[model samples]
Target: MLIFKNLGEMASLEYLYKYDMYFAIFQLTFIALLGYIILSWLFRMWKQYKQLKNDKASAELALLKSKIDPHFFFNTLNNLYGLAIKKSDEAPQVILKLSEIMRYTIYEGENETVLLKDEINYLEQYIEVHKIRYKKTVNITFTKVIEEENISVAPLLFIMLLENAFKHGVESLTNNAYINLELIVKKKTLIFSVENNFEVKENAQTGIGIENLKRRLQLIYPKKHELLIHKDTSVYKTQLTIQLK
Candidate 1:
């Protein structure tokens, strides 16, 4: 009878061992499936994140380009209108300059980056257009010290600042108005500043140009740029520094 009980005990132990083995295999399979599901979910999320980032960047770039084009054209047309009304002798020259500006904007402005020299030439042309309009009444001085002419930068980066200087500073002033602009490049960094004198109007509006500029800088340069603006009773100053990649 004792031998029979021992045989039954052994048989029970063997059955338990087989059951544990099956359970272990099932647990391992479940764990592997869970891990695979988690990994697939993570991959999908990462792909979605990348797609959203790309879409946002494209949208911002398009919006920036649109804003720049309209702003520039409106200002230039306004200047042309003034010249046309006066029937000035420089009207033809202004038209030619406008054509050149339009051509530059059409070709180079669409580019993601343009040569610093080309951008400077565009600025010179823009300034020349305004100089003809303001004539000797407003004193405008532009100085550039470029250590590297082959440097490339975003197109129309400085035009807004220059436009603001003219719009708020010299445009409304009756006499003795002045605008000073300087661009300095040193050791992979570009420093630009614009200072102007203006009479404070009671209900003056600082337009959207500065905001647009700030957004563009944030997108393109991220942590590699600095912008400073100072205003007082008589003078308004803007300074921007960009670290080139």
Candidate 2:
């Protein structure tokens, strides 16, 4: 039996024990809540950073593809002007082709991916436009074998190679200038090969377009693409392979 002179002087060990336990539980709950909040904030920040990086890449690619060479448009326009003055029967066809090319470049080129067939058609149109501008005979053969259907690719991925081939190969040589291109799509893979004869001794394999293409491949395809270049005394050959997802 115990008797206390003052009731307030009595401190029960059981009550003290209960208080300690509740204080510890409260502390743990508070720490857990703080940790959860911090982690959630970090996760949100990481997601925002990733999204921003992707958006930047997309913007850069759009700028790159939208640059369809102002010189090309100027020359085509000047040529069309002359043809129009002469009332040439081919003026309408030329104008139509030009319009189609512009439409595709302005619209479809901005897309992340486009149909392989559409890209092929755009390439053909580009070739036709170039052929019309030159008086010299430029033998260009583009062959394609697409076994896989509904395939998609990053837009304007191969135009730089074609542009480089013509700029260094066909434009410099006076005779026997040729560009041969082949595209093979099979087994969920796309292979594009270009071979051209060049006369320029230097700077045949270097250009802004090709450099940008390299950057783009790194960004878009990463490990899924392979680009190979072969050069000899008078020929430049390149092959690009892409693994379709």
Candidate 3:
């Protein structure tokens, strides 16, 4: 206002030349203020864009994780149904194990992470449930060496690999089938591997489980984890290493 008043008081156009310094100062100040406002607005928009992208990613990951529960329960219930039809003595124990697994899936699966110990227990229960279904036709072995008990891992991460192992390796085998799994944790790294004998058929199509697991791993672990799968003749093997830190 003071600058404007000074300019207004100068009646002659020639007098305006003497106020060139004030005019230059005012013009620079206005441009600086305008630039600041525009930059601030752009920054705010960029921040919101990143947040929305993250939210969408999180939502998609949650949906994928949710699919695992129903798929697992469906298979488990089918096993129970088979046992019930046969009136097998292991039916009751299978039911109990299923109940425990369901409890973990319903409660702990909702969490982003669970204690490594709890996850291992869940896997043991899952393997036990499968063993009851397979009986003497299949041999399953699980070994683990844990250097730390207090570690945390994403829920349901390893289960898909185990599921794939049983589905492709032991489910259709009539006799002499075996699955061996090992888990080793050293410092901040965890290594899980599963190997099993499978009878490969002509034109066997892959299932959605592996793709789903890959997508989940990409979203959760990104570059922090490694998954390797190999098949040779009748043997299929997979190994996954995750960086816990």
Sliding window of 10 residues with minimal summed lDDT for model 3: 9-18
| Residue-level lDDT for 86 in candidate 3 | 89
Q: What are the TM-scores, per candidate, against the unseen true structure?
A: 0.83, 0.88, 0.85
| Collision count for each candidate, in order | 0, 0, 0
Residue 124 accuracy (lDDT) in model 1: 92
RMSD per candidate (Å) reads: 3.1, 2.8, 5.1
Q: CA lDDT, every prediction? A: 0.88, 0.86, 0.86
lDDT of 2 by residue, 1-245 (tens): 33563433456666787899999999999999999999999999999999999999888777776554565678789999998999988788889899998898888887889999999999899899888878789899999999988999998888888888888788779898999999999999999999999886655445577777878888999999999999998999999999999
Q: Name the 10 consecutive residues with the lowest summed lDDT in model 1.
A: 65-74
Clashing pairs in 3: none
- The collision pairs in model 1 are none
What does candidate 3 score on TM?
0.85
- Model 1: per-residue Cα lDDT at residue 229: 99
Candidate 1 residue 52 Cα shift, in angstroms, is: 1.6
Error of 2 at 131 (Å): 2.3
Off by over 4 Å in 2: 2-11, 201-206
lDDT of 1 by residue, 123-236 (tens): 899888878766558788889999876899998899889989988888768999999999999999999999999999988987888898999898888999999999999999
